[model samples]
Target: METNSKETLQADFDVFDISEEFGFLLEEPLTHLPDHYQVWLDLANNLIHLIESRKLRDLVDKMPVLSPDLLSDHRELRLAHLALGFISMGYVWQEGQHAPAEILPKALALPFWLVSRRLGLPPILTYADSVLANWKLKDPTGDMRIGNMDLIFSFPGGDTCRGFFIVSLLVEMAASPGIMGALEVMRAIKVSDLTGIKNGLIKVTQSLKKMKEKFKFMHNHVEPAAFHGKLRIFVSGWRDNPMLPRGVMYEGVSDEPILLSGGSAAQSSAIQCFDALLCIQHEEETGAFLTRMRDYMPPAHRQLIETLSVCPPLRDFILSCSNSDLCQAYNSCVSALVDLRNYHLNTVTKYVIIPGNHAQSVGCPFRGVGTALNTTGTGGSNLMVFLKSVRNTTQKALILERLS
Candidate 1:
């Protein structure tokens, strides 16, 4: 979708939606930056190019900032330093070159940074601190207490978290070898192979379990009391069949029982139980559902409904083979879903289309929907644009009729 105007762009940037807009702005060389920053800009561009080209060996050797010493520095330097480290390590990994035993420390640090803090690293640390502090204040002896009160604790700590981190690290390590190789590596790493690795894994799993229990408690207790009488809707999809079970239709039912067997019925039964729907397969189903929903939903609900309908493609490839029948079917479904969603969106006077999961692909029209949502988690931005368009069109029509 085209930006409404530069005014809208500025307003969007005023909030944190600039990241969403960043995806759009990246389509063109940023004319907004001053000429003086060209060196830094060029450096950043070259860094990305080298990383992408798998030619990081020469680049990393020359860059002191990417050295293992910098990577092991305090938390503040970790993110920037680790990103550079990953580019170097990724390059080495791509070339089928394992780091020397001495250099493996640096290689391990790269994935540790990626798993612990790459995306939202600083914020996660801050949040973890806040959570631990709150827990300590409430229950000093609780199991939720942060063991390393001074050192930044990984949020969602425990064995499962560790396992996930390990798996992610291994996966990134084996990305060049592809998924099967990654899985093989995961299987090869026995619990006894590394000291404290089992304990770390256990902590991750326990922490995850605790997190789930806490969420379940909060959701059951807090959410019902807070959002009582409101219709809650949960929408998700199944892109990979292997990720799901065999013999299951793509666009049919959810595997989760709360959502699958009784979610819709529960919503229908109780004033408190919210309506939920999941589009498991083709994007087209989401579009069709939104179009059908428009006739029944109020203006307030229409925005979120529209947003869900217009979500971008949720998966990269249906399978490894691009030319496979599954890929074709998946693409066709996504295309149809997007078209239907847009058609329904055009029918509305004020609506929002928030994107989820697959927010990258510009080919999908709904990618812009993520931008339109801004950061408020509210439909105001979209509603404002839609309402303005409708009002302008109405005024134009009245003027034309008068002239006629």
Candidate 2:
């Protein structure tokens, strides 16, 4: 990474601190941050406070009815997306284990649903519950994706959102032991003892294969309403649009106008973190492709990924090696990663290609498709760069070992 990029990534850390915002909730955990991560944090904070302090009916009265004209530089409608998502998340998560599931008051629920319908956002895709926006951890010892993603859950169709994140969490967590084992194997690597290294690679490959299956299960079971729809007005400009609301400018600000908008790709920063753990690197010269995709993730998470990219375990595996068994193990690992990448490509196909929902109303990223082999975010799942990098690195090892 370049020095400037290093500095940029360091800024991508997690932001939710319990006592700072909503420590007063009677019980239960404060699982996410307030939405509207725009230019003004106050805008986001104030809107959430309003939702918490006011009666549901009063709040509803103030909100404008859903309409296309309402989207013209409308801060109220934008903040409402955040306000409702935050309130509903809080309402749902406030009670802890015994909390009522699906029990939001009609005042907040009805309008939120109506607005979400207008925006092409599912209730699950809101800032609070979105895999893109709300996923973060209180602490990560190392490798953010290895142990923490405390927030990023995908809801099942009809069931309550309770078990939603856990399924994805399980898939990610299944790789933890394999990663540590691979690390252990890397540390013990020698010309003679290929046994531990090969075993470790096999385990990692198996786990990824299982992860692929899980993704398929997730894709198959996903309710059409969840990923299938037109994108909301706020996100209509997502990655393709150069325009920002009405007057939001690009020059004076540190981030692009889209970064500040509710529809920006930064909302899905966690997915970028996932790509990093799997060793995905994008093309630098490509404009707004994977080259700068990491910019969409939080600066803090980007830092963590950068730190891990150079860590001894994963870094050492790719540096140089001449052991035939080690090379074989790495080749198998590459195959497994390719399998997962193929699965991601298929995921894009299901959402974008097969179903053919890539239109604007289909909502920001879900509408676009990117391949999983080389580039990213073109049309489907954004796992391609990572997949390609891992394969290239391992293939290099195979060549070096054969040459020796």
Kindly list the per-residue Cα lDDT of model 2 for residues 161-275, writing each as its tens digit.
2223434444444544444444334334533245766676676667667666556555443443333332122122223322212322222111322122222222333333333
Candidate 2: global Cα-lDDT? 0.39
Q: What is the lDDT of residue 126 in candidate 1?
A: 19
TM of each candidate vs. truth: 0.20, 0.46
Q: After superposition, how far is residue 345 of candidate 1 from its true place, in Å?
A: 26
Residue-wise C-alpha lDDT for candidate 1, range 1-404, written one tens digit per residue: 23653454445333311122121111111212234323222333354345335555554444332222323323323333323323322332333212211122233333333433433231112111111111111243443222311111121122322222222222122211211211121222332222222222232223223322322222222222111111111010111111111221211122321111101100110000001111223224332432432322222223333332343322222222233433333333333323322333442212222322223234323211232122212111133343333233322221111110
After superposing candidate 1, which stretches have Cα over 4 Å from the reference?
1-13, 16-86, 97-335, 338-404
Each prediction's RMSD over C-alphas, in Å, is 26.5, 13.7
What overall lDDT goes with each candidate model?
0.25, 0.39
Please give the lDDT score at residue 129 for candidate 2. 30
